[model samples]
Target: MLEQVSLFVHSMWELLVSKHSEGLYNSVCLAVLLVLPLLLLLLSVCLCCQGCCGRTCCCSSCRRQQHNRARRKKHDDLWISSQPQPIMMESLTLSV
Candidate 1:
């Protein structure tokens, strides 16, 4: 069954590629011509902005660092809050 399925797929691929090679080639060329300049422009814009942020060349990296710092701070705050308070325990013992 697997062999049959593989053979079927291969035959279909061969039929489409061999029969429509000219049309497929033309469409691929046209798509490349249309998309190449836009891709280049996007890359240029990214390169231009890469150095705009102070102390960091890449914007995404700076943002990631800030996010990580904030997350660590939050985790540290939670850990500190979860620990038992010595002063509160001493006060309770004195009241008792």
Candidate 2:
């Protein structure tokens, strides 16, 4: 049984080596080695974008823009309210 298993492994290795010498096998291996990582990177980027966008994939930029606009509006409102009002001359004269 051990001898049979060893022979099977040897035969499989020889077959693989022989196939590697063929251009088709090498091309397939090269494609997998090169394209697989690019495919995975693209997939990861797409998934990350989807997650960042929350419920919608197409509105990530739009949502970010809206958030920025809302934040700016809030800041502007706060700044306007925090400014000191100018004193009228009549009121100042009356107070004195």
Candidate 3:
């Protein structure tokens, strides 16, 4: 087991060294290392803003919906009240 572990570590080290010798791998690693923190920072800021502003954003939509509902209710009430009542007809006589 010890020998196997050492062999695995050696192989991994060799692979890393070979990739690093290519130059591109190192640059890629450097770019990822640099960009990763910036990305994480941006993500944290976005999450913080969302947590802080979520309620306010939701409240704005809620207020708009409430306003629309109130307007719709008012319009509906007016429309219904404006309709004339149906007159009752005692009978309809048709003479041929």
Counting clashing residue pairs in each candidate, in order, gives 0, 0, 0
lDDT of 2 by residue, 18-80 (tens): 767787867588668769999999999999988987666466787788899999997777545
**What is the Cα-based lDDT of residue 83 in candidate 1?**
62
- Model 3, residue 22: what's the lDDT? 82
Ranking by lDDT: 3, 2, 1
> Best-fitting candidate, measured by TM-score?
3
Worst 10 residues of 3 by lDDT: 74-83
- State the TM-score for model 2: 0.34
Stretches > 4 Å off in candidate 2: 1-22, 56-96
Whole-model lDDT per candidate: 0.76, 0.80, 0.82
Question: What clash pairs does model 1 have?
Answer: none
lDDT of 1 at 29: 69
lDDT of 2 at 31: 61
Instruction: For model 3, name the residue pairs that clash.
Output: none
Candidate 1: tens digits of C-alpha lDDT, residues 1-96: 999999999997786566567697766766687699999999988877875644564678788989999999977764446667566665565434
TM-score of decoy 1: 0.34
